[model samples]
Target chain A: MPSLPDMATPEAERLAQEAAQPADPHITDVALKPALFDWLCRMGDGALILGHRTSEWCGHGPALEEDIALANTALDLIGHAALWLELAAEVEAQGRTADDLAYLRDAMRFRNPQIVELPNGDIGRTLMREFLYDAWHYEMLLKLRDSSSPRVAEIAAKAGKEVAYQLDRASDLVIRLGDGTEESHARMQAALDHLWPYTGELFTDDAVDEAVAEAGIAPRASELQGPWDATLREVMGEATLTVPDRRADVHLGGKQGRHTEHLGYILAEMQFLQRAYPGAEW
Target chain B: MVTDTLPSTDTIRNWLGEVPDPEIPVISVTDLGIVRDISWQGDTLVVAVTPTYSGCPATAFINMEIEAKLRDKGIEDFRIERRLSPPWTSDWLTPEAREKLRAYGIAPPIDGTAPDGRTAARAARLAGRSNLAVDCPRCGSTDTEKVSQHGSTPCKAAYRCRDCLEPFDYFKCI
Candidate 1:
């Protein structure tokens, strides 16, 4: 048989567009503030890097369903990165599209944090990252829903539901592995220790966050931590895993455009198509 | 805001509901409650809606559907904007729509604990409602269990009915 793609691909793409664009502008002031734009860029940078890392597991996942799951999550995060980049473009007021921001930037220029670029070490590491990121995203969206900027709030409102589900999945896995067997629990704990430091950086403040919060575009990062803690505790307890002790070594500065060494390599692959074919459009 | 020889807002809104949700073909976007405000900005019929997820793959098709549906209705000059704040909640689901979703076998999302101090509304809603227990659509029994935290889609969960020994999908909230 010729394959389901013939039946599903076009329809899937069509559906994708429909669910994204609305018939009306939620917040019609087309102008994007520079600081807010930077914040968006920073956030996109993190998401896109994380997405690229996850996509590397396309054919390498332990199971078929899991392979698709990782790929799907990768697509969702990248798609979100693209949307945020589009918002950034508007803020720049330079007529740049999302493609321009995503494809044009060089490695050293990326603002994503170090955590996202870390190699997908093992299933344990992937689960660790997912647990942290999903919880962070869920809390952030909850705060974002009340954003002064109605546009951000709307995006959070819709995205929040999906994030919640993702978190639940990740949390379930964490619990299973932490309580599964000696080997799995050890691996999970190791992964947690390796990844925990990065969590602090996710909630760090920068000028963009300040401006965006002031503008009502989003909430302060500080406000998210309390809820994040509660959520993490709930999940950890269920998983029978002790939460990683709060680390003093805070990994900060991604929001300020500084990133780790791995970001360069990731960006090289991500931006290659765009840079090679300037102004390329599908 | 009536114009010369133009139809009323009510008529326009009714026509707009003709647009079906691109993913769930069984229901219209209006039925999903994603369609928020519908108004005219000049000749353009601007319809406001929120996506079910930030990175939902169906976004592209939803936009096309809206455009095609409106164009078919002889209205163009339309634009679809993605809204993020006051974020779309499952609580916005209409009772009629919820009933349809349940009949369709998709367990609708239970509302979140309100973050905006709307304890009164939440309390009122909780008080007035019962049957939060979801029935497995496949087996038509409330003795259903969540199989996995993740389902085939981001918005759904894998569920199995103990009574009927059938597995189904449940729509979940973030």
Candidate 2:
């Protein structure tokens, strides 16, 4: 049968043929594939880490509605994580799968930005963190949709719609909590201040970013800050929460594989089953 | 010995129609629009399926069931392909699926397209309620309210009807 021209192909088959089609086959750089692989890990790591953090609230949400909503959000992020890591594995051209990368790697190898790995302090902080992350996440996906790399663009299209829904919810809740009663308002403001330092790492671009952006595989990490700021400005203004003006470069090194101690604790819990029993499957 | 002629594409679709969605048992995978395409690749059968949402955990199980059903139908040469582009959409749900959802006490998605875009979503935030006016699946009253933007599953949102005081799941648009 003829290939279905309308249907999207698998990532592996596409990547295998990616270099042959000369239109914009940047994967031929051989040197660039590792950088692309690292960049993909950053995308996957953040989603997986934040998804794990959000899922900690599975049965513990402040309210039933919030509980169910947070769990759903966690599921969506995990799903995105799986997709990104799957692509990352394919690019590594190594014999590893997404599961192996997720369950086998040590914390030192993880490449998620620092903000996501921080503890979910409280309901206010959790919501505040999600809102902050969602704003940045949405902005990046919007730009990734235009990536010259087909795999990046395809996953972006698939994940973009869901992130929009997530951002919408997170921003709405942040506004209500930030502008509500005095107690809630104070708590939200506190959460913002605590989380503000972490947000700086999200835009700290480096060599991996430069390689991917030059290859047209992904955008520079710093490019996303502009749109992220626009969203935070509009949403924070409405929420009556003030953006911390201290600094935007207070934290960095997450994308470069330097992570906080929290990631190790997270991995112990997250990877216990797979670590204890190698290649375990249900 | 097998015959040279394979089952028609329509016949394969009919067999797939027997597979119920794991979460929403009332609807078949076809009804939910997860099965995107079916065709023969030489002697092998190719089935393209898209997950309703990227993170839905049920996708692997659903794929297994599809494989099992096809195998049970005596089709040994087959492969499942995942389609992501022209990504899955709720608008693809069959009209009959909407009816079945209503009968099952889950509100059909508001006759809405794709995701409610940012502008409409922001408007709902401003209005302090959902933009879509969802009718009660049970009481059939228009006076209903959204309880949460998400629900027990990624594909659903939670809502409640004022007249019936009944909480239900709304098949989320996109």
Candidate 3:
């Protein structure tokens, strides 16, 4: 087998090559800078992958009310994804539609953070993951509502309301599960412990985020950290849960298209119908 | 009264007012304030619409129904434009439509001093806990409790009234 460093070099080179090329050759608009376009895709891809995971619980939730709630949340995320991806397609100036970006891309091309692509282990784990993400998503949307790009601003303004509700639902559920029976409390704590390391990736800033921030299209990912921490601390405090200590070696690189094993399975299931029957529409 | 020229914008708007909402049959599209604007672009008529919520599944159906209704009226050259800014809210529901929702056994959203209090409340709810008072349509009592945030449809919430002991869907302020 090749050495770990040798494997890393080729992947890094491939990513560099991919970055140099425009997502679509047909895109001729110089105004839509490549960095900003990538940032938009990152936002949309995160929502799409996470939304797909949430939708898996459609008929299998612990309770009837929860089943409906999860489905509703999934729909909201998917809707937000459509808006962002549609904008991304416009920025690319290609004939590619939102569905093209969503269903056609391979796992290696997705820009979603690794945290969202992780398997939904259980209700406790799922809500914990969602709470972490929704808090950051809500804060980011709050800032994006004033984005310099009119399209981004419009999409953010509409999606902000939906994300707020998602944050509320997830926060409430985390508190309920954390403060409930002994078994539930232990499970919730364990879920948080398992997922805590992934939380750091949500606030990791890179060139794409910096470019988008400079252009006033989105707030820097680092700027969201303080508010995210405050919200998590408050919610966790109320739930009688402790914030796990940050690990020094947090997994990264999902923004650069490197993902966990789970993404392939998700793509396989989500893209099956679309790939099998191209141009299939209802 | 018939003429070779197409009907005026006012006439088309009036005809659209007769098209009932697919989900809430009691309210017309115009009454629900989903129809934002109507204008003529060359020979084709354009109707601007905004969905009540971003992810509302009813939007496509509403668009299709609007097109079919206009086509049925012998006006085939029409297009629907979706407007996202000035987003749709429950406040847009006309007073007449509010009454109709109540009569249909669904609680109408509360009118507030703020233009879109529900949207505002959602932001507030994230910061802390905020609750909106939804009066029961049956007993007209203020004693009601939210059972679940998710309801039969995306636009409604499940609520139960204490006095009437009946569960009803509240057209939640969005």
B-chain TM-scores per prediction: 0.78, 0.95, 0.86
**Candidate with the larger lDDT of 2 and 3:** 2
What tens-digit string does per-residue lDDT give for candidate 3 at A1-282?
A: 111111022233332222222133213447546886788889899998998999999999998888888888887888888878867876776667677888899988899999999999999999999998998898888888787776777778788877876777688778878989998899999988988888788888898888778777789988999988888888888688988876712978899899899999999999988889877754
lDDT of 1 by residue, A190-215 (tens): 88888888888777776767777776
Which sections of candidate 3 miss by over 4 Å? A1-32, B1-6, B112-131
After aligning candidate 3 to the native by TM-score, how far in Å is the CA of A32 from where it should be? Answer: 4.3
TM-score of chain A of each: 0.86, 0.91, 0.88
TM-score attained by chain A of model 3: 0.88
Q: For candidate 2, what is the DockQ-based docking class?
A: acceptable
What global local distance difference test value does model 3 have?
0.78
Predicted model with the maximum lDDT: 2
Q: Each candidate's root-mean-square deviation in Å?
A: 6.9, 4.7, 9.0
Question: Judged by DockQ, which candidate is best?
Answer: 2
By TM-score, is 1 or 3 better? 3
Off by over 4 Å in 1: A1-34, A58-60, A63-72, A143-151, A203-253, B1-4, B94-105, B108-132
Q: Per-prediction fnat values?
A: 0.27, 0.47, 0.24
Off by over 4 Å in 2: A1-29, B111-117
DockQ for each of the predicted structures, in order? 0.19, 0.37, 0.24
Clashes of each: 38, 0, 0
**Local error of candidate 2 at residue A73 (angstroms):** 1.0
Candidate no. 1 TM-score: 0.77
